[model samples]
Target chain A: MNRRPVFLITMLCFGFAFFYIPILSMIVYSFNESRLATVWGGFSTKWYVSLFSNRQVIAALILSLKIALISATVATILGTMAGIALARFRKFRGRVLFSGLVTAPLIMPEVITGISSLMFFILLADWIGWPGQRGFTTVTLAHITFSMVFVTTVVQSRMVQADQAIEEAAMDLGSRPWQVLFDVTLPVIFPAIMSGWLLAFTISLDDVVITAFTTGPGATTLPLLIWSKVKLGVTPDVNALATLMVLVVGLGVVLAGILMSRADRRRDADARLAYQANE
Target chain B: MSKAYKTGWFDRKGWSDIIIGLPYVWLVALFLLPFLIVVAMSVATKTPTAPPFSFGGDYPLLNWEGYERVFSDGLYLRAFLTSVVNAAAAMLLCLIVGYPMALGLVRVAPAWRNILLMLVILPFWTSFLLRVYAWMGLMGKNSWFNKLLTDWWNFVVPVDWAVNSIPMMHTNFAVVLVMVYTYLPFMILPLYASLERLDTTLDEAALDLGSRPHQVFFDITLPQSVPGIIAGGMLVFIPAAGELVIPTLVGNSASPMIGRVISDEFNQARDWPMASAVAVALLVLMVVPTMLYSHFQAKSGGAK
Candidate 1:
């Protein structure tokens, strides 16, 4: 059918190569015996061993995971509510301002966000004694503030596309507004919510600049550690750590792909069965 | 009209009000308040006290001295220029590399499209710092990547002009390269969204009217995808300009970007007012362009 254009294929090939080559090289070099990242020596797992032994790296990884988990969960909850208000509620006081807040984080420079939030925390500490210091708690709050914008957009789109009749029907059947939201709307939008959570989690985990501003001493994240270490030079231990992260992310993506395709196939089968019955 | 359904007490409007009010409060406190504080800090005087900045002492409350320094200092001005140049270059490169791939994804068969799109986004899921570090490894002088580039350069040019290595690291070139790599997905996704929704029937009609493929694309596809182009460009450009990680990691330390300057002023020099001034200036630079872009976007949207 001449659908496969030569120019398009070439572009795709080059683009994907440019994207994957650096990461693939890092993974390959992680196994290299040589201390130098580029020089190929015999494969070894010593870097992996060293990465495990480094207590700072391990502590940073744990801290990052904890922050990602807590921030993503809280952001998802807040974002979903905001999404519903924008999508379901026709009119509210200051609706324009609400929408602006949701999208501002998407475009605002990370530096501005980082600096502004740091100031906010310090001001809060001076005014009140709660969160007496800026550390993990402060970083988590900052991440949630920004990452929730992404979550809101995701959930808002899903909610906008969702059928309203189901929720209306539930409400018609004597269900409370909260019940309609919980039983009908939430279930329908659960997939979007889950993906929103994942998006927030990854963003929080990978964040460097914002975390740099918000985090205090003894609360270093993985990216912060890697940044400081790479300033010294790329070590084999960091390469090993990157490889493990790639492995984990790769598995998660492939699993999601498989699940999506299975769902699609099931939907196709259902449609075909209905068509056959009608015939 | 008869009221068919009863509104339960629990389902009343108050529930919705409370639900929405909570997030609004959180945003006002966390997001808006912080920015306001920055604005205040920008106007404050630098002091030797604990917080390092004070609103008023012997000096006037609205101190324009930090902003005066930002405007007069050549170093800060140069940093601003470098940031604009570097970010613009990265944005242009991303557009060039991303446009074709996005077009390809839209044109390809459905079976392979999803997989390819996944590939485009999969790298994004990995840590950005690690990805930049990988470039550092590649661009370093004794690496195979640099050697390969050096060999290619030597092959193309006369032997005398060629050197041992191209010296890729610690330069604006490396910064832009890593930026394009990191932000290519941001450019591609919006572009694909707009490109995929394009009416192919318009292209078919143009072809039937004796237009060539290139002519049809320029006339129909390119004009229609302008929205996507703007969206992608802003997404890449804004972040690339504000970007601290890639520049500090790969860029030459001789001429720091504005983001670096802000960090240095805040952390190293302990100049909160000056850093806040720079931050405020950077925000102004970004916001003006953004407002113009959205204005154009709305104008074009309204025309359609």
Candidate 2:
């Protein structure tokens, strides 16, 4: 047990390298002076300049952000509801069905989900005469449906791990259910909710296949735009865009990591303080 | 307590109802109901119009043609084969690459584990499209990575067989490669979660009783992680089997995967019934493993 399995360490490092190399290459090639993604003429920021100026990409990016924002917010609210219900209620009518629905999306192929939802939307339009076109509304709806799965999973785990005694005690102290919820339950699972929102946002932003199926020609998301561009072949402009996205996502993740660690340490201090005060 | 708060509409029963009922209705309407609709559309006939499958043509309107085509068509069958093969290869490769890494994270000093786990998850946060696109750049003809591989191929293979850059783009090889890369983190995270919970006492006892480390690993660790493996495998396999992006971007067009076939049928051919049929078939194909995965998940008691 004491022996450092050198093989496993090498495998770990190797796996990380495999993950990072393609990302690093994309970043490097984004600065390429040549129009070619792979071939380096000299280091230049011309591609970034063009990428920022590109109206289509800009439009797509803005639309994606808008969808992500809306989807994440709605999914978080709904997912938090579902998570609490699952974690606390223990059993209810159609509980089995509800759990199945939530977890199915987590594993279901996007193509099937995408196609089925598209047909479902079409049927809705034909029958109800609403959502007449598969545009922003349809795409946003599709995103919310799937992205909520991540949110539910995240919040569910957190809710399960959360100490329910506090809520019980709050009720005993004459806190109404809503008061206990808002004051105690919500605060305890706040970080999970935040991360869940973030996950939903990213999932919505990054989706392509489902978005493709549900989106109209008018509603091209960032991933869709990226897909169309990359399908032709790798271009330096796309590389630049990819690099910028990678940096943004990477920074967001690092910031989140730091915040979480700080929060964790603060939690430890709070636990100790609570113990001392109790004594 | 406040009088106004006490008389609020959200009573205890009301609160519970809202919490459970809202998401429940949303899911049934969007998720479960759509699948049933897909099943209905699968057997309908394709007509030439907006919402192409018509209800006015025949009273019963149960055109088994789409079903027949799905059952009998070589293209559909071949596509299924390609998807399964490529996805299976990717799933196996991910487990191979990720298992050791997961074990290492658990084995390493406690201080480094979270950081390493974060590294595994960081890529997952970035745009999946961009991640696949990164591989495209690496695999392109003039790319240094491809050129390096080309040189290696040239060195190893017979002189006549070696000429130019390796065709890493637009092949099943590329599809599987990218799928493995895309899904490696999914494999690792679940494996890590399961492995981290494993008791070391059993391993210590086995080793102290004269069993070798590898023996202890095979006899104790591997058997216990069956649920993890199934979870991870299902996670990787199901999605990879139905992956649309990688196949479209990098796969050989002549040999389309199941996902690409369904997309093309719907988008290009505009055969709604056929697309629905294919989608139904794909869903049916996925049912066995999906059920197994859910069963394992329920037993594992992770999340509902």
Candidate 3:
């Protein structure tokens, strides 16, 4: 037991060092005053201040956030509906197709998805001219397509494990089907929905390949900007940007972790109270 | 319970129908239709038109020329091989590194488990591109990290065998390193999920039955975690195989991966049909392993 724990701790330390060293260096260098990224100079916050003033990066950030938000919300709704249909309406016609479509995106590589969608958009525009040009709308649509699968998988798994008796009891008490869904089913699966939304949001935000293909001129994203900059040459401003993003995501995770632990404690307390009442 | 109340105004069947139909319609339009376009374009001949390909008017509806080109061209074959090799290496490395951490996660005190798991997931919240870029900073020829590695190497090797800096950037080593760093979490989380569920009594029984600790792990823990291994392998392998950014930023341009080939063929060469052909073939290649994974999954699930 003693030996095992030592080995485990050593492994975790090494693994975490491998993961964090790169990120830590990036964050540290972001504060460097040197224009050269690798060279260390006295610490300064000028790069971060410059990052905000850089209209291109700022525009791309806003665009990415908007796309992530809208696509995640839409994907969540559509995916939850699909999840409910899959879990509750098992014997429906086209069930196989429905299931297949839901799982297909999981395995499909982003490159293939990207090229195919780009072609599809081009052909669609040629056919109808409805979207005339590819930009935010096309990027958002592409995001929604890929992200909905994650949402569906999350929601469906939760839905399958959901207590059906509560929903049935609600229905038996003269509640309509919609009422049972809104009042019972939705509440039970709410956590899954929220997680699904988060997953979709993150996926959309991090996406480069799919967005690279689907996006047109003026639809540049943060990843795209970073990619171009890295290709041209690494710069200090990118380091600053990377650091800020790390801080934002780190804060978000900490907040989420705290909330999750609190929620778990509350649930435990509620269960304990009910147990004592029974005694 | 009272008799089931019939819906007087609203039809449950109708609502269910709409709910089911929405995703079906959306997927068919966006997902299915787009894939069909690629398949169609793969058969079309390149043209001077805006979309750069045409299927109708004198040209035959189907042309196997693109497919023929892909098979004959050594570039595509080499790229596919590189992708598979790199992805497999990355997957194996991730497993080697992640398994212990995951095992540790399962063995830790229950109160600390969630906090530890959060630590594993924390780095993932950061931008993946940024993380890869960080590797670029570390692996560059003039960087302090490279200097440290080179200094260590010089100490180990003969004086005559010493060099200034190991060419880490634009090499397979850089690609694999970044990939392992990026996908290690994918490997650990799944492994942890399964390892946590393992019945410790089985391990203890093996230990008591005269098996060594290593023997018990091989005979018990390793066999049990095969499913996690496979899931993690797939999760890492699939993306790593199709990965464009990692290879583009860090990898040697001489031996481009399939992703770069597709991107280059489309964006640089303007060979849309050829790119489509390669993309389709790549999809076909990926599907075989994915299907094998599914088969293994089904077998394991059935056993359970």
Candidate 4:
């Protein structure tokens, strides 16, 4: 029976308050009637009305969703492969370099990555001329580079925890390597892959600096639009937009959490039934 | 063997090789190759024409002006100084604020842990730009939040020291404050991960020997969580140092951060070579801590 100290509990409360107050304030202020972000006017839904009609914001939101979806899917596939290679393969050619490449983006400053990525695209265009303009294609590619690193981390950690015996067992039963992968290894790490995809999706949607560098000529993402607006000053409609984003992303996360926990509970039940059958 | 089976002969080895090689190739080209290009561009001269920079132009093939300017110019030097000082402040503040929280999380009951962890990450799922914008609203002069803080300051301090607002917006204080808010989760998560794995029995045993909690903490718990501290510190420091949005939104332009300067050099000045040089310099600055973190990771991975 350990007595948890009051001081630590106080810090815990303070930490969560610090994290939430700005957000709670933003959401509350979004309903204000006044144009000023800080001042409270009588409650009004006018900003939300304006936000819905804003053509630029709507276009940017659509563009951002498209980029996030494409980048997240591609990043997840590549990241799963990279994660498996790291966790399952004992050794491989250029493993250190591969590992470094996978993890480095997680820590590398955005300014550095942005500058380099932009230059790479330019050089790439000059050489191959495939991605002709710096727009949707370019931004999606840039998002994939850093976003995949997050996917790699999530999948790699999950892969490490997964039991390899099941995979080996499948292989021993005359299943080909790909069959074992699809049947055993993939299923086991599927939760990690799903969460990793979500993380990558969120990162891509939230990005600004890399998107700014890589995008051009009317391919503004939501964050890029928000950045330009916020740069000038805080507007009432921006607050409304922020509140909506928080709602959508928060809902997605909660939904994912429920599904994962439910899946886990079912697995536990199945394992218990299997044990009883053996007895 | 049937002829059809010949294609499957190299299926295991070759297929796995391709599976592994695909990501490796994509990264080397996208991540590694781009980095090399930045290094090469750092040595190229700025031009007024398209591509924005070239080697062996009217000037020497290996132009060192960008690197030279980075070291010699007052703006670059001051920007670097601002970045380091601000990043260091944010890193330490995050540690101060995050350490106790992480410890509290570890000490809590097991059934509550997962839920609390999810709460910690929930904010991070939201757009980062919005979070900074929230601060912008809170810190603005006319805002209710600002008035509350200003009123408290006037009551605490002498009457003559009072001001209309606390001058929070467009200051280094604002930059650091927003950063501490933004990066606190990064600090807490790693610290939690490390502290959670610590042997709790060790704390209980030390307490059994009549060692005070603080003494036990400093001697036992603190040492164990040092790795967590470093991991969190690097995560906070490296990004905060080069952050663009938070600083640009909340920070003063007269004395800008390195990231703002890089953007200006690249966009406003149309000097890709200079931006690349500053980026290369930033990478060189970051490489040491980056390597230390990776080395720690490799060691821990190997031990596992």
- Give model 2's share of reference contacts: 0.79
Chain A TM-score by candidate, in order:
0.93, 0.95, 0.96, 0.95
DockQ of each: 0.63, 0.60, 0.62, 0.59
lDDT by residue for model 1 over A76-121, one digit each (tens)?
Answer: 9999889978887766789999998888888788888988888778
Residue A166, candidate 4: C-alpha displacement in angstroms? 2.4
lDDT of 2 by residue, A1-279 (tens): 545479899999899999999999999988999876688899999999998889999999999999999999999999999998888886579999999999889877898899888989988998999887888999988888998878999999998998777777677687877788899999999989998998899899999988988999788999999888888988999988988888888888889789888988999999999999999
Per-residue CA lDDT of model 2 for B234-279, tens digit only, reads: 8898899889999999899999999999999998999988988888
* Model 1: per-residue Cα lDDT over B194-230, one tens digit each: 9999999999898889988888888999988988888
Global Cα RMSD, each model: 2.3, 3.3, 2.2, 3.1
Task: Sort by DockQ, best first.
Answer: 1, 3, 2, 4
In model 1, which runs have C-alpha deviations exceeding 4 angstroms? A1-4, A270-279, B1-11
For model 2, the DockQ equals 0.60
CAPRI rating of model 4: medium
Candidate 3, DockQ score (0 to 1): 0.62
Better of 2 and 3 by DockQ: 3
Best by TM-score: 3
lDDT of 3 by residue, B100-210 (tens): 999988888889888888888988877888888999999888777999999999999999999899899999889999999999999999899889889999988988889
- State the weakest 10-residue window (summed lDDT) of model 4 chain A: A1-10
Displacement of residue B211 (Cα, Å) in model 2 is: 1.6
Q: What is the C-alpha lDDT of each candidate?
A: 0.88, 0.88, 0.87, 0.87
CAPRI-style docking class of model 3 based on DockQ: medium
